[model samples]
Target: MKLPRSIEEIRSDFPILSVKVHDKPLIYLDNGATTQKPVQVLQVMDELYRTANANVHRGVHYLSDIVSERYEAARETVRAFINAPKREEVIFTAGTTASINAVAFSFGERFVHEGDEIIISGMEHHANIVPWQMLCERKGSKLRIIPFSDQGVLDLEAYRSMFTERTRIVAVTHASNVLGTINPVKEIVTEAHRHDVPVLIDGAQSIQHGIVDVADIGCDFFAFSGHKIYGPNGIGVLYGKEKWLNEIPPYQGGGDMVASVTFEKTTYNELPFKFEAGTTNFTGAIGLGTALDYLTALGREAVAEREQALLAQATGGLSSVSGMRIYGTAPGKVSLVSFLPGNIHPYDAGMILDKMGIAVRTGTHCAQPVMDRYGITGTIRASMAFYNTEEEIDALVKGVRKVTEMFA
Candidate 1:
């Protein structure tokens, strides 16, 4: 069978792309939940475990020096990947969840006051919502929501109106996981800055789609997971402005985060180390670095354009389906489609698609507020990466149609 030339070339780099489900060819379209790992990232992790394994930043041995050097170099790669101002501004976390939780505790402890409000959007993933809720409950602060329209675009005017003297911070998703709505985060940041409030962008869904310049966005903090960008799990990044990192307290207490420890008091380490507590996922960090390297080599702009074509093809094909109610028809969006067809439950559709070796996510997608806003239990979401092809999208459309017919 002849495949599309570009994606065929790109797909070979990912070993899992060839996987089969139920004795049928696997058509992996669940990039939003977590992207598939590339062989390049896996090989880097494997090489580390094989020959150069050692605890980083701890010992004077040769292996320690080697591993520590590679680990810090990986931090520098991430620093450049997002165009962060300094390496010290990059802090490794378990994933996006842990990164947001870090800011919730540390940023909240330092800046938030009772009766103060923090702004977020209705389209945010639960990772963005629950952390602030916890922070609000702990501090007696309030959570203010910037509502979206039926099309899943944030009401920018409502957003501006929501701010008040008591509004201390704004947390938002750069792209909605379920909706694929690419937010105007730079504009959001500029608006927040006028009120002297800092904004944190959850970049879990946005980063893999294209380049994300924290410097360009001017967001105070950004968080994303490695797995969302073809890297290993158990690794994520928190990119904070230097001022915020300096002002916020440590999120956890453990080794390496301290400069010195006394029985009475302890002086914490500075900048990135101050926020990073305990032995982190060192191998995973290396794997993330390799993934970033892969992206860099491929050039994010080229990858983005490829995915855009896939998005257009998928959207056009899926729209032709009868009774399809596609969500988040923003003029600008990443490569994903979320929809419900003709009173069909998303779970039922997803199960049928799976038997045909098509992987899709169904239900709330961890953004229950979005579902509540639309009065939907969930949606069947197919998120694509640059490696996917027009053929795969055609397959997805066919699968959805089959499900609809099956139900009919």
Candidate 2:
């Protein structure tokens, strides 16, 4: 597949593209951290605040009604985005961290027991790993890790062997934020189901790459962040099967989450509302809906193709640089390419890149366990998005080469 010659049109939609850093045009490659929002998403949030700002599900006035309608519409949009079976299966949270925590707190409390096991892969972000650890610690359950091979791919045989009747949950990342390895979630979920273990997929990195079908994967829970998919921050989604969601207890208590609260007892609301508590991020959710729409209009297949080609170009270009060591050389990876230059700290390299107006992330990327597994401190990560262009990749290559020349 041919790389996009010019992403000028798509880049124009993001106002931040015009930003100047160090007297040079910004070359943003820190997409894995959080993506630049499109004009459409910003406009949607602006419109919501201007015309439809009000508390949802409680007000009867015109503005309140409109706000409530838009808020619910955003939930529906998220439902379709992940191809979730029912709208009630979609629950909004602060971000992937909170979403995962909700599942850990509610489902973990009910299902987990002493001597039970929760399986996680070595490449999991702290959001996915720490919650399960806490749950296991609280419940006297054991936490098992699925080790990865030297090439950064999960060891399937080892993973299969880890499953047993005692395995209560299998939580893994759909894609590694640091390594860019796209996991075989469908296979993992199927294997876990054979033993009747629930699976939760952290999709913070995968959602922007291509379409994510919760039904197809058959996982019990899927979590992703809005900001990583070109939406506003402080908004995310947790998709669970209707049956599973119905079974899990409420994570929080608040006004909207309760159907009736009396002096003695209270009843929780239905499906999603039972979990969602307090005033939500209304404008951020609206922005998330707009972001999903923007990505849908661009088409998933096209976005995937473009990003894969860019990954190929980036890997190929960087391979030739002397003294440069790239991590996550696994096949079927995503748009991220992480590496370390000889005798150079990733933070120092990141500072040098910033001087050249190339923004990239450096460090453990919230996957400190993965770093510990590999015996490395950290890496320099350049993650891509659909709106990025070949020129940006070229700039990244040039910047790396310059860094290598100076350090190596």
Candidate 3:
């Protein structure tokens, strides 16, 4: 499970790793929020802004052509990265939230109706849950939740039984952000298809952790944020099957989304462009492509192994601390742990950890339903990435213990 390059060499790619917060080295465990970008992604984006800054697909000038080529090339990169069946299936959006909204609006308008049911899981982030709820409200449809167990595992039997002729679509997360559970999305897709329903996978947390093949997973739509994977912010990908993309109407209407416009009739553009209305984030897309290339070079399998080792170290160290109660103990989960240190409020403990230069998220983490399920307000989350080290894990353990004692 050795990395293709030395860990120190890999760490050097991200300059922020060397920073000192509160006079202690920053132990960034907030990777689930957004990953720190490497210099490669930053440099490419800066280069684009400096040299070839132009609106894509709208100009015939030199700069516009170059930027457009690079922008569309980024789409190919996304298609290859996810093993999508076609390049036109990849649509760039603001982020995962926007991607889901596009699907919810377009898909719901086309297919959902009164009394139709939308199925989602208990572990879904608000991004996944809220959009479907809004759609259900608009169409008089019902939102059905597939509950998870105390161990954070979804009840597959319940999910299968819930499906009926009324079910319209099934949307779920490939992994749980709060629970750190890697769901059986392939199986979930298979089961949904059995009932003639399509599935959408929210890959915001799952994309950077391991290999993702939408073709293999057999999902109709896959959405993820670039910033979650060391790419630029305000950029994301929504990969839809070609058939589905063509079937659904455009999510937006603006310049490039229309092929030809008359006062009376306007024909929408084809596949990917139909969804990308205004000026697309060409620089962000190129930067995301660079980030994907960087991950490809690093070897996703090795990166997963490295992160798993870090997760193992973190889980074991955190578990040994007295009065520490860890959540999301599902087997084969990703490299994150959410826990409460005794009776300490998560924010209080998080503040102490921050002074020690450990950055962890202390909140419901945009998954309030999960917190309600556990009957708690929030928990402290330490999410790891491949660039993290075992030393950082140990430092976090010591920091948490200090926070616990201070609170006590």
Which candidate has the top score in TM-score?
A: 3
Tell me each candidate's TM-score. 0.98, 0.98, 0.99
The lDDT per prediction is 0.93, 0.90, 0.95
Cα lDDT of candidate 2 equals 0.90
Worst 10 residues of 2 by lDDT: 1-10
lDDT of 2 by residue, 20-112 (tens): 999999998899999999999988888887877888888899888888898899999989889998999999999999999999999998899
Residues 1-408, candidate 3: write the lDDT tens digits: 568899899999999999999999999999999999999998999899899998898789999999999999999999999999999999999999999999999999999999999999999999999999999999999999999999999999999999999999999999899999999999999999999999999999999998999999999999999999999999999999999899999978999999999999999998889999999888999999999999999999999999999999999999999998999989979899999989899999899999999999999999999999999999999999999999999999999999878878
lDDT of 3: 0.95
What is the descending lDDT order?
3, 1, 2
Candidate 1: the clashing residue pairs are none
Write model 1 residue lDDT over 150-221, tens digit each, in one string.
888999999999889999999999999988999999999999999999999999999998889999999999
Error of 3 at 387 (Å): 0.6
Each model's RMSD to truth, in Å? 2.1, 1.5, 0.7
Tell me the TM-score of model 3.
Answer: 0.99
TM-score of 1: 0.98
Error of model 2, residue 94, in angstroms: 0.8
